[model samples]
Target: MAVTANKIELMQIADAVAREKSIDRMIVIEAMEDALSRAARSRYGAETNVRAEIDPQTGETRLWRLMEVVETVENDSAEIALVDAQRQNPEAELGDFLSDPLPPVDFGRVAALAAKQTITQKVRDAERENQYEEFKDRQGEIISGLIKRIEYGHVIVDLGRAEAVIRRDQQIPREPLRQGDRVRAYVADVRREPRGPQIFLSRTHPQFVARLFEQEVPEVYDGVIEIKAVARDPGSRAKIGVYSNDSSIDPVGACVGMRGSRVQAVVSEIAGERIDIVPWSEDTATFIVNALAPAEVAKVVLDEEMERVEVVVAEDQLSLAIGRRGQNVRLASQLSGYEIDLMTEEEEAKKRQKEYAERSALFMEVLDVDEMIANLLVAEGFARVEEIAYVDLDEIAMIEGFDDETAQELQARAQEWLENERQALDAKRREMGVEDDLLTIEGLDLKMVVALAEEGVKTVEDLAGCVTDDLTGWTERVEGEKKHYEGMLEKYRVRPETAEAMIAEARARVGWDVEEEPAEA
Candidate 1:
């Protein structure tokens, strides 16, 4: 008994394989052609230029040996003279490929094996290419699949047409997945590799929760409500910030649904992760307060220079505001994109008192005045001695305890104290090996020059290397104490703007090219 080769059966097999593999019909037909061509070449001479084609409509398979029509024949197997080519086709021209039919091949044991391998390889390659094209554009999308198997704690999911993997770390914490269970995850990434396409799925990503809400909430799906931001703690807790373009539509309420139906759906999908739905505000302060929801905020002081916010809560609300191990503040910081420092109302009051005492003490020591006089100066909003010396007499006289004569006397004392300090600083500057170039810098007085020399920064280059904090004495540390050098600029009545300008001038003079080192993390 011998196996009969049927062209119709070959076409039927190609169609079935094409449908099963989810690849193009043309790809399957091409694979069949490659296989038949390889089989024909084995039966005929290996050097023969064999080619195969199949009729997509009729399933008719044809085999041909191709020869080039050349002016003169070189190799008898590949090329034919123009006269011989024209005999077969009268319109034959030079360089034209002419085909002559070859006898259909009868499969031998080795030839059949070779043909099967060729078809399998071609079909596998086509399947891989199709899979890559199908899933590459689906990145960042929510997809559903069945868990095919688990390999070393990694879940391999069978998406209808392809397969995806969810690594152990990508799965939500403590969420157990069983084989053959239905799973939904976000398509984190798709990569094409030598073997095939690799699809990476995740359930722990912040966007995964966002996508789930989009699926469950109609307002989000229609773009009436937008997910502003999301911060997730995996299977523990999460916070979502949402906004609505239409005033009539409440984004948070829509996401929550009637009696929490929509949010419940999302929570169920993510293995019951507790979620906080916060209304997004255009104002950063309000948004931060919302992000720290269920925890009352008494006050918020923003430091735009540092991109940080000091949030003050009631003494009883401190634990709630900070959450367990500071999780509440940490998530709020992530959602709001600002660092937050949590403090109780009592703590803030104490801090204010400390600041007030520091300011009053500075005035007392600098002006050689009594504590009462320093307290009166600070109470009158005189932050620095320069303000008292240079301000209009009328403004100084407006203080409750000061008449015009008293204001004048205070100004005189301030000026005299500054002059004496400058003379002493100048003597110290000369005693130390301070360079004259440091004194030439604009806005840098003798006192600042002496301070720099004392800190071993005698040259303009050394001063340029010092950061603003060091130059201003803010970085100075006392032995066995947490007190910093209450900044030279602050102590000497130099304006912060003036100190910055002086540092810039020194840097320009020295032409120091190195960037200042960043503060330690």
Candidate 2:
């Protein structure tokens, strides 16, 4: 009776552990079997190979020592000679594993403690693995849980099945969240570490606002309206760029809802953060204008090479456009994916006047012309000496008060100046020890060669090692600010395609595989 009861209790313990840890029952049984095997080995002899098994249905325990059938026994503890093995089983062959059954082990206090520890460690490991698997694929999702505790400015959330953390930086600034409060957050990341699975949650994530809109707006959730982009100041303000596939639907109106109910619902969830739903446009300039809502943009000048925009507003609108500490323009930049330079109309006028004067001066110096003729060239938008040297003579002739003979004279002077400049640049390039082969690149000229050598790209192989971004710069978001890294040819306004083709040609000349990649659509 006692032995039968003991076996039933063992099975019951395995079942209880599986349910408590939310693990597979078979896993718990396997862990228990391993624990028993370890305990049996301690008693039998450490060198003896032992295994344990429990019958799932009856909870009957079985322990055995494994021995190999060998032609010549090397160690009698683990091997049996073929003739000796055949005596136990007629079918036994050399190299076959034979089991030697032993009487059940009596659990001594020390052995029992070791067995318990092993079972516990195994169960805990399995539980951690299960937790990691559960949350690994749940990243970028919205989850709600009760705030269980606050540790060193981090919020520990009880997600019912597992614990997740919203680190200090992930929380909205000055947003009051207390213990026992139910909060929703974006699942920023999930990592499996030695301690366990760590699920990172964020309330201040820009996508968190989008997810909230998805919950509040039916049209957005159903895909009739799409959120094109989002930028948040977190707990203070946000902008959402929305688009509608259906022509009849107003995406911004839909997101705003009846009497502002939908937006208010989202606002309440995110600690009453103000949201501006701007209609998205395929035209970047139109989109940027829309993103800077309530602040009228009198003019927008886009620099496609740098992905930057200059926005000119009225003087009275400047403060509103810039917001407190430049927040409005900053968020607009983030939302539109363009760096914004906001200024008043007066400031823009002053800048234009300064540019006109500079251009006139440049023409006067390079073409050896008087102020009136230089001003005429500047007014005709001839900003560079290269334009005068290379542009069609008809463009200069077409300028008012300029005859074809005068246009021809200007072109001659411009060409002479450019050739002289090119010679000087070439002298500098040679002095810098730049390889002459670098000048052989189809798109690179003497000026570019000098620039490349100045930047330490002195050889054909050096140019071949370059990526397109090295010659035509790139813009990226760093800590929520748009940062522009000037490229080598950025002053020349070199297109990425031009830079890439030059690099590809250089690489091909240097014996690299330069298979042309199809342009992205």
Candidate 3:
């Protein structure tokens, strides 16, 4: 075959190939270098003394044979007679090697074949790397791609270089996908294998809300705003916390865009999934209020030590605040970093009334009382301890098992328990080493504590007035001890407000420091 051996012209071929394959020319040059080396191996297969070189800049090929000088030519490929060697090198002697450049063997067919194969391999490898790098960091991100095919409810999305699998479980319920239809999905995972790289996709992740934001809001990509947290129940509703680094820029506004354009774009992608964008706040109560947006909240009482929030909403907003199946409140709790308990004004009032009744009561053991006595109490509309404590002994004797002595004993035991609880609470308060203030802590559920706080004992000083006998109701043995209550108060990390409420109530009953604080001047 007719061949052209122009070094400059071959460099042009490297550039052309690099451009066509969207690859570096250096890669083409490297491939060509490797190819020519292989060709040299083929050309001088029997010639151990042969070596080859090519000009990387110009793609020129050259071959040289390192022939040994000998008195006689024993091996034609490796050795030449000293006389012949002297013709090439005048100072050549026996046992000395000589550099003899071989006339250019036409690498026309070999170089062309090698260059073609090498370039093809290099381009394929580059494409594989590019695809891997593109999808690796995109895990958990939402992307829309054409559905290339569907196999038994599993979808294959054409994500440019490769297809990602959307397993059946990860698909939205009843969302139909057809080939050539564009589908929006979450990039659940990316994995590399011997075959190639696999990108696993989904339609059911809560982060899909955030992912949709990334696609719709350019501010997120440009770093003008950031998403702090996301809580979602997919296909229903979601809450996302957003904050702006630039004070002038409202992160929520940026995400929402003009007339809800940005958020609308995301919502459209998710088939109208509702998203609530809230301003992120370090104050947990404020955050919770915002997370439960579109639901009017009247008050948020935070139990900081317990990481809980009591949210008060209007009677009309209770169902809205809680949402269907408690989803809104649940997501708000997660997003705001507080365990939320929602209540309406009416519910709160009822709850307070019940608590007040329990508070004013004397100690009574329902487990110890006979069914006949309990029925009598119920018939007399005295289902609560407060009524039982104040009930007259003459009224109690009207029932079956009560003698005068038993009635007196039951009444006295209730009074003693009530009194003892007050003293123990006062002692705990003094041990707390504080005065003029009370701690309202949560997570203290001891029956004894409840009894003591009901006695209007406000301070630890009042708690010192009671003994173990006061805390023990009619029961013979208390399951938990005083030290156990103390340990729970410390371990459960009751908020200062709850502890204060408990102390104030206790002190009021004990009649110690009865003077109310004067109004602020």
Q: What TM-scores do the predictions have?
A: 0.63, 0.75, 0.49
lDDT of 1 by residue, 119-143 (tens): 8899999999999998999998999
What TM-score would candidate 1 get against the native? 0.63
- Name the candidate that leads on lDDT: 2
Question: Model 3 lDDT vs. the true structure?
Answer: 0.71
lDDT of 2 by residue, 1-521 (tens): 24598788988888999999999999999999999999998898887888998899789889999999998887877888999889999999888999989899797999999999999999999999999999998998899999999999999999998999999999998999899999999999999999889999999999999888999999999999999999999989999999999999999899999999999999998888999999999999999999988898899999886688999999988988898878898899999988899988888999999999999999988888899999999898888999999999999999989899999999999999988998899889888999889988988888888888889999999888788888988899899898999999888778788999999998889888887543423
On TM-score, the stronger of 1 and 3 is 1
lDDT of 3 by residue, 1-521 (tens): 23346777878887887777566777777666666656665677656566656566656677777788898787888888999888878998888888767776666676568757866786667656667788999887778799999899899899776779999988766666789998888888888875668899988776777767877888898778889899877666778999998999999999999999999888777667788899998787788888998899998888776787889999899999998888899999989778798998888879766754454341225325554554555555554554555679887666666678777766666666656766776676555443533343232343434444556544455553433333322233366532423322433354544555544455565555534422323
lDDT score, candidate 1, position 511: 70
Between prediction 1 and prediction 2, which has the larger lDDT? 2
Residue pairs clashing, model 1: 472-488
Off by over 4 Å in 1: 1-5, 44-48, 67-100, 301-308, 344-521
List the global CA lDDT of all models. 0.86, 0.91, 0.71
Winner by TM-score: 2
Model 3 residue 292 distance off true place after TM-score fit, in angstroms: 2.7
